[model samples]
Target: YLYNGAAYLESTFAAFKQRLVPVNVNYRYTDAELVYLLDNSDAEVLVVDTAFVANVARILAELPNVKLIIEVDELGEGPNPAGATIAGLVHYGAAIAAAAPAPHIERSLEDLWFLYTGGTTGMPKGVMWPHRSLIGSGGPTFKPFGFAVPQSIDEFAALALTVHDGAHDPIRLLPAAPLMHGTSAIASWGVLNSAGSVVLLTSRSFDAAELLSTVQRRAVTNLTIVGDAFAKPMIAELEAAEERGEPYDLSSLRLVVSSGVMWSQQTKEALLARADVACADLLGSSEGVGFANSVAKRNRLAPTARFRLGPDAQVFNDAGERVVPGSGERGVLAVGGPIPIGYYKDSAKSAETFRTFEGRVWSVPGDFATVEADGTITLLGRGSVCINTAGEKVFAEEVEETLKRHPDVHDANVVGVPDEKWGNAVVAVIGLEPGVGATEGTEAELRTHCRATLAGYKIPKRIIFVDSVLRGPNGKADYRWAAAVASDDR
Candidate 1:
């Protein structure tokens, strides 16, 4: 589904009921990228917004498997892009109103769920998950107040009806993150399954004011974001509103959840100071959910990068032995329970990532971390994007986070480029804050700032400033773009 948040829910639910796997296409993808994803997924039906009709038209002939195109007339005028005419074209609203309701099919726990990775490291790959496993991965955490899991669909329906009865109220959720991202879609589905309502922002882009205003107007109870990319801007908007004596009524908001990126403690603390809402930073990926989770509340914020280990989550060293906490060994984080089967159509990659060790299978998606003395995990970022310099490993996210902590740095992406001296030199591609230009000594200043907390080798060997750092709609770092910039600089 190519539509925005909540806009595609009807079609998504329909596809799920009919056992048709919904393949997510990042709206920011180019025509070629879109075609590759659609063709690779073997998609038979595509439901897209009118705005994307032109892009789809360019690749329609290449995607023979896509037999039908359902266009959502979001603008009400029913815009049909030139050359987009197809034999099986249908408008979303009209088709829904005219077609008879589909009979309910028996859904098994083994039903398939596909979520394509953002492809920060390489080409996007779909992660294959079973419905039962996916539910087990995220369901327990999203359980409705005072309710337990239902044994059957009938029981679930009955429970859903009564979930909002008595003293409990239905959850009103707003997913500020794009629905194309699993983080937002899964959370939205959990809310809907609990007989709750989902509020969506109409703006095509991430407008902090629009999101905050929607939350206030809808009285949304839960808000989900994709870490600092969303939180930092939203917090700035809130602060600006307060300064102007027009603070939003955020009292109805109870929970703010973030996943898929590094959420800083500073941003969380700033948010908590403005409201009493609880902030949950979930450490997860397309492969699985619940590697770890950290919750922050007023006066109870956890340190940045520190997360309470999740159920069945452990750190494994190179030899596949579980890393002992407080042993000071850096290892890859793995989750054993309720993980994806493997990456679709990539057996070698799948075998390497999902493996059996000590009689248990685990999904290790290359997230480097360390176990503290108290058993909490400190995330070091994805090993797939780790930089190797002078035989020492420097996680890109660690450096990127440090760079972002700078007062003048708006955003940053760290990458490793070939270097004669260091083998792989750490390079920082930064986006400075508006009105904060890089002076002659700015790079030196950034390096000095990093030296305070990071080892000398971990600091960037070169700093490249840009107008903006390339990121996906879900706010994930675009390492490929950063690497290209770093290569050009080299």
Candidate 2:
């Protein structure tokens, strides 16, 4: 697992980062830390993931001067949040290696390829990727001269549906989230594919104030956030200040995207409210399939649709049947056209996630989703988080949603706790709305609400109210963290 994120650092400091980074290197951080890293690098070009806009856009008020703000479109073609730009954007491949004048310029699959993984679950690592590995539907769009991508919604959205015609600008990026994860790195790769610039956020501080100041001073056009982790906090900061009548400017920004995790309906709307520009939410995985949504479009699919990943993907079941999606039946998600080369040094884990099916090989990222007849995929969350209580099986998210609507409840985590009566009983750890106090008896009130709202099995048998729930930098409710906290609380 050789790491090749050298281009991310400045030429003077590049040597320093390379020395410390060995075969397998991970770079994990929050938007706050990412902002500091980018500023310290003093990069002129910023290659941003569309997911971290909420975190970095306002901080643009801090950066004094910066030239380009490139946003990577991993799928290459899709409707973007920004009102279409005239002709400057490109995917990483084309933008970086185009040598119309510099005939001496050259690029190859041997060039550094960067990798990102989910870091909040563990330490962030950066895997060195070679260009040859970046190809097809699973890989970055490639070309003989260099990698290319679609330029506008017409080009990208069309190209994603059809075969690309080698016409995308390397969308450079300033990933507002930690650059150690696949979602952020792949977004950056989209820019690198075109040899476009990737602005690094190297500082240890990714302060929202710093980012807002950077955008305003730098005139940054693109910013992305990773799900609600980065998004909700940022908007909350702004909203909190706004409630106090403090004004902040977020006008220069053009595009903001949220991905890696699904943004709650409320957070998504809050972010869209801040934007005079476009906002998008994407869903995909490092080892599986990828799709994006917008505030207006709200990415969704009917249960009966069948999607063709072109020649790049296919469907199958546990028995290896081509698990065609219909009647609400879901199957393991797989990728073929451009599957990853398995995990680094862990072939067994790789084989588990990456598989061989049909005549072609496939990689199942362990997500259970149904593809509708219209081609849209309906994600049903992680299979590991599936809840089985009593004789019925329920997804934890379904129950969590019910708890969240309690009006007094701000958030909730539903996990199966041991029970002699019903086997694994449902236990919910809930965070209440701000200013509301939780008494020892608060659980009873919340339970009464659930009884009125949810099915009997779906209702939690135990409710533990906490002042606040702990989350990773990404804002995702760490079930493991919650599990330990709940056990300790009990």
Candidate 3:
């Protein structure tokens, strides 16, 4: 299992450099989950951090295909480390120092890059990204920095050199999101491809203070985060710092990119007020370039959930017709650019996600959205999480975003539970801001707050305030957990 660190990057590049497949293992997984993922991915070699050695040690016997194990010590060289208990484990740094120089091996455009989905609702599936498809998909990501898509290795090398020619400083990027997810890993690859420095947070869990301090210290030019899960805390920290009259210096940051979940416009505007950075909220999934993106600056601000569709992006209704602009009809958003090959072994899912819609193969990750008259799209939640209550359809994200707009709400996840009258009643699991108590009038206050933006039916029927709303490491909502909590509530 890899954590977000230099060693993780090193192992990833080393695997690619040696033409070996590198599978990312979520450190937060249970022993069974870990075993299933490693075995399913056909992972032969394991590169794990010492911090997670105990979990690996327990599940090591189950993985027979894993012949070699390499242990990376997060702590600097010390005697009797945690990984020392694991049998037949090679030290990461020592192995590199003793190994012979790598032999020249010609790489192919067809070489596969395995990116496992977040698996919020199901088991994580590996998405196969060929070098050709992956590189082609990154054109827009690098274009903003004046870096062109290099056609050949020679051209790529030339571009890398140009970034470090003293006339132009190489871009320093810090992906606040974990590298295990595609959101951060792909962005880091783009930065490294252009000879830019990829800065990582040493802390395992996210700390907004550390992120700001690192950006100021390293002169980071670009940043990547998930959604409000990361942004909210960062905003709080920035405000706290300013209140103390020692605001963080964020002049070097030019772009703040987010993906995986809905990034509220309120958070984007807050960040822009604090620093002169453009927030690019990407509408995409692990399956695919993207469906759409909303870029917010000081003046050029787009509304929450509104995005301009990509060149090949479209929404298709159940009747297989393109959704008409200004029709107010909801449909699945599809992107038909340089997409993935397919899921590694599941042909059924592969066919379902990467489908032939209107004679064109588009990666449809089942995101529900509506087309506006001006050719922009307003995103609803994912189809998998849409709730049905009394014959009325309510997207979890749409309601969740509305609830989060309240001042006291730190985070919110909406789920549907069994209701006698409604069949499925909308229930909200909310996390309040620091020191904010959930009073008897809290539910009424939130309901009143949501009524301004949300319809009566769309408003959450029952508000459950927890210490904090749970989410995956990638900032994807834990709907399953919320559903369970709601279902258990009388």
Candidate 4:
């Protein structure tokens, strides 16, 4: 599967320019998952890379509403590796070159943008983002840059044109996460809307060297990554390069933005020590943005998973009461200002996720967190993965963060395993740093490390050391995979 390169960007821009809704498809989806998304989105046309043509061909019969298939030939001129072909499949370039020019048409702010997001346990859900909503949700993107929020189309265009006229500096961003994910796609769209440049990696997978070299060569001003999943590897590359006596030139990078997962303070400090870049750890989701963010520099660093809540953000208990700061009570995080319209074609989930809080509509994405005395909130992972061991609640993120603090551990994931004594035992699956091996007493050593920061009940009862902890392409934790491993080994 190709990364979100020129072809993907071209399709997105073309569709948006012509007032057509663009739905992003995950390249890692199976044939069944692909069919479900296409069918659920009510898609009329499909654009796919030649590398994935075989899978699309297999699922074609299930999608009757798909009127056209535009093939992007990523695999040079030879026959497709899978020899998969569908009748009436149009070439991407040919379709573009032979198309007649489109007539000017008035576009509305109500036009929808479908962003499909697959959470931990369900089929992908299309989050409906209208153009008007994008203005509000996207406001945060401009805020950090000291740009004024435009009130009208004329004002927006006038500001965007300044980059071309040399009146304003241009933003060149590289989204390290797959563009199919909201964290990357939203950043990409926001950059384009500001008349900035978006640099995509040619490599199909995440390559730290490629990313660093591109940053140096393209003079990337901003970068978007998904938490420690990306930060750790990039940091490893930087260290490796330094040890080789040839460090990368990261002076051009002004800012580094991460969201959708936990970006540890150690990793942030590691990057800040090497590069003069500000790291913005965002706490939000596809349903909403601007919930909270923590900006860190070398001199000024924030604690891990600690964020200053946005003006419109609030945490509410199950009883629908506003959570008190320093109360030590967990609640669902919600944001009221400038939220999505809702999920497409799923009224039940839409109603559940986006609800009326007091008088304003707020997005509650089921994240659990506690407010600290300092007025900052500490995220405690999602409620879905929270483990209740012998009536004591243990957040996987809290345990995982403590475990990763150990020098030998590169990554860690905590999951609840079936236990006869505790009902559910808190089990950890850890991946060590490169060249680090697990001995017979490695589990005990890791457990001792966890005891320093975690409560007795919260400390993992069982630790399963694996070669590496697996995460999704978007850098989100794969709790399901961890659970399976814990179950099988038990």
- Clashing residue pairs found in predicted model 4: none
Inter-residue clash pairs, candidate 1: none
Q: Looking at model 2, report the run of 10 residues with the lowest lDDT sum.
A: 298-307
Ordered from best to worst lDDT, the candidate numbers read 4, 3, 1, 2
Q: What lDDT does each candidate get?
A: 0.84, 0.54, 0.86, 0.86
Better of 1 and 2 by lDDT: 1
Give the TM-score comparing model 3 with the true structure, all chains together.
0.95
Question: Model 3 residue 91 lDDT?
Answer: 81
- Write one digit per residue (lDDT tens) for candidate 1, span 309-418: 88788899989898998998999989888888988889999998998877889998889888889989878888788889999989999998888888898899999999
Predicted candidate 4 versus true structure: per-residue lDDT over 1-490, tens digit per residue: 3457788888887888799999989898888889899999999988888878788788888888989888887546543555345778888888989999888888888888898888877899999988777766777666654676666878778868777898878889999998888888888888887888899887778899999999999999999998889999999899999999999999999999999877889999999998998999998798888889999998899888789898889989988888899999988899988778899999999999998879889999888888888889988877777888999888888888888878899889999998999999999999999899999998889889888877899988888888888988888888889999999998
Of models 1 and 4, which has the larger lDDT? 4
Q: Model 2 TM-score?
A: 0.63
Off by over 4 Å in 4: 74-84, 144-146
User: Model 3, which residues run further than 4 Å from truth?
Assistant: 77-86, 145-147
* C-alpha TM-score for every candidate: 0.95, 0.63, 0.95, 0.96
lDDT tens digits, residues 1-490, model 2? 1112343332212322233211212223455555544454353455544343334454565655545555444434443454144124333444556734333333343444334444324432233344344433323323422424443335435544333454543333556765545555556555443444455453443556555555556555557676545665677677876897864676766566566554566665565576565565655565633432434323431111112343455555678766565645667766665445665545666667767787666767665666667655555556667767887766676577567756687777887776788778788888887789888778887878878856788778877878776664444567776677666765
Off by over 4 Å in 2: 1-130, 133-172, 195-206, 240-246, 288-315, 321-326, 372-375, 401-408, 439-455
Model 4: weakest 10-residue lDDT segment is 75-84
